[model samples]
Target: MKIDAGNVNAVPSKRLFLSIIADYDLNRSICELIDNGLDVWTRAGRRQPIVIDVHLDPDEQSICVEDDAGGLPREDLGVIVGPGQSGSVATAHETIGIFGVGTKRAVVALAKQIVITTRYQHAETFQIGFDESWLNDEDWVLKVHQVDDLPVGTTRVELYQLRLLLDDDNIKMLRHHLSATYANFLTNPAVMIRLNTVPLEPRFFDNWAYPPEGSPQRWSGPMRTPSGKLLRVDVIAGLSKESSPATGDYGVYFYCNNRLVAPAMKSFEVGFTRGQAGLPHPKVSLTKVIVSLNGDADEMPWNSSKSDVSTKHHVFTALHDWLVTVVKHYATLSRTWEGQWPEKVFVYDDGDITFNEVDDFLTAKRAVLPNLPVVRPRLPVRITKANSGVAQAKPYVVGLYEGVVAARTLVKQDLSQRNWLAFNLLDVSLTGALKEYLVNDAGAELSSLDLAQLINRDRTVSADLRARVPLPDPLWTKVEQMGRLRHDLTFGRAAPKISDEQLAAADAIVSEVLARLFDVKLAA
Candidate 1:
């Protein structure tokens, strides 16, 4: 095995670039291009504003992303051609995209042919383009040339023959992701990002405030390790503007050398410290904590993509100790306030529509509400806001099965959901099964057995409240039919979660149905 080391590795795999791109989706792929542009802009000291424009055209099957940052310099031309080479090392520490493959990988993921044009302030304007058809060749060359129309201090990428359709849903998704991805930069007046012709505004975390204006800083300090290495941690804990899901931008942020490596994270999520030991309380989401960190690169642990921060560092352990002390005082009022209302009613919106307006719709064919997405549990709901712009919209008409089903009171449905039920009772691997009824031609997935027949079904909602919205007579018939079909599939019997293979197949089918739903929603 230890013979002469004369084996020479030559001719790198040409498909490596193309294959790595498969890991990124439309949103992530688009973010890669935007990140490169921002890096150059930040590297230039942010003295002037940078305007980013994205043009999407489905009919042409093309997309163009342009930015007014300092374009690629002639000296750094190898940055793109080389797989891991980076020019940002000498530039700003906060600049993103050090791997150098961002723009190339993203552009390749979207189109068969791509043209990249750039103009540095001092260097001549140049353009380079390549086609996917050349990916198989071991020695493919990019046709580079000087360009006259390209302006100085600008970088642009034109994509042709898109692999993914530039449809409306994807366009909206791009807009949403870009705004969130660059939320920190877009918050500044100097940076403007536009999708197609529309300007994108940075959406902030519903839980925490940024920069806090003149407000006193809640927490800021440097955590010292056994050695002299210093890990700086800064945090601000505050109330959210509105109630939102805990998963979104609602927690701490971690930055490595001024660039954000992790964002909107709760303390417990990243570490094994005492603060993370407790289960997340229902009120935990109301508190937004922006925890910014800065330290030597080697001291911090960022995943390869730089999207996640590891909790194994000593600084994280120290920060956890500090957070546990302060978390008790942060957003503790939400729980006390909720005690006044019934468990079904939680604080939401500025006082407009409540949950009742959304889930309380009339029964329709195949459980699909004509006015909304899909209804769950039961229905006869509608969501309408008031005409006055200043006043937030409240439930216009609180539809009541109005004492028809005994003395039960119905709970309200969240208004945020328009197309699908916001809450799922089967919040598990089977959650997607709830929506499978919409797309599966095999028939409704609902059980033939009545929900009331299920044990402790009343625990889902107050019976008096739930009984107010009677199960539509038509639904019971569907339940019966599905029950019979399921029984036949199992040889005249029913079993709880049949087989591992069946579970995997069910998951695959659900994924296909959701994909189709996306296609239908975005179809021209």
Candidate 2:
């Protein structure tokens, strides 16, 4: 605890201690080297085709990353070799890096030494070397050697004395990690990445581009806020073409300069992804939201790592607050459009909803057939969470929210459009629920015009008919019991199921709802 600031010896710059190198794993180090090459390509704005080839040879006990991108300049070599100094490369698209420590940290984390071979255009090839033994002594300078073998306009990273060994599985994992981390980049035809001479294909997702079918369920042209800032919003919801894992892909992603900085993040305001911020997983898996910032580096929200957004930044915070609700409303629309209550809402007390005594007063309020004031029942409530879920491929959706309804296709592809279902959310004071199902399903799909007209006419008709969606006593009691049962289920307590008598009572309530809300009678 004593202060001894008198004499401090200089450690080999960029401090790569041999012992600390073991702290980082092999895959991460490999990713770091690859990210360096990627940053270079990003700075150039894809004017040239960038091809990065990674060579992982366990037998040789070395890892190499070579890219056809514009290599580091001679003046810039002093920074990477010495410390985590990012030279004057902080442009808008090029701002993903911070302090330029990723490659340095990853190199030191994986091995005791590294040799960087690079050339810029027709410039002479130069090599920079760092050794672990320098930590014990005073060897700060990395001798730069000119070499002729390295290709012109390229850079290669050769890692030796690796702390972690590489096998087939490790190599496979590295490939997968790269695919997920840079999936957005891979989506572009102009950008290509390879592992061991094989080109890695980007995982495709529905609505990634414009839909091949009718049109995007929801699309927003570029909109400018009051502050004169540009914003882009694109939204798609419902079942994936081949819904693989039920919770595979969902949620809104934030992209900076065509690169995904935060994948499927619930906005800071209303974020609901499974297991994060005390919100349950979304009931449906096919929902995907894309909110991107295409502006220059000044407006981007990315941190130094390029993996997260800086919530505290002034400019980004303003833009996010201004445009976040637009995306969230679209998300709500996506979930409610199809009207699957179990998939659309989550019941029980999560501090959002408070269930009071069952109000079965509707059945008594009206006394005739086709009773006007249809008291529509609202089931589970929807919540927003902030965290994201595990990543997935095939569907490019960045799965963030969980608890999505498992996809069970009645008909896989409704090519004729007749099989598609029509439903809309109607705001009703009944049950204090915002979701009101207009039509569950019919033989035909609702055309855009019909949908618009229905939406415009719903309030007028409901007001005129005096429709009140009332939860009958028995059904309301059943739902109330189910809500409590969910608590017991969460607490690992044994819960009992409703008997035939209870079910019959519930059925009677359902029939009443049908009669009052949609004017249909259930079979006996």
TM-score of each: 0.57, 0.55
Please give, for residues 1-524, the per-residue lDDT of candidate 2 as tens digits. Answer: 89777977655443444433444576556666766777777777668888888888889888888998788888888767556576425434544455465567777777767889988777888888877665445656667888875676799988888877888998888787577666777877777888888877665343332222212243334434334555443333323322222444655566665555665555444345332222323433344545545544544566655666787765445444334433343344334333432222221112211112212211122111111122223221221111111122211111111111011122222423212110000011111120233332222245656544533322132331122334445544443443343334335555333343443443344334433543332331
Evaluated at residue 470, the lDDT of candidate 2 is: 45
Best by TM-score: 1
In model 1, state the lDDT of residue 50.
92
Local lDDT at 334 for model 1: 32
Candidate 2: stretches off by over 4 Å: 1-28, 42-45, 82-84, 92-95, 135-139, 187-189, 204-248, 266-270, 273-278, 282-284, 322-327, 330-524
Candidate 2 TM-score to native: 0.55
lDDT, candidate 2, equals 0.50
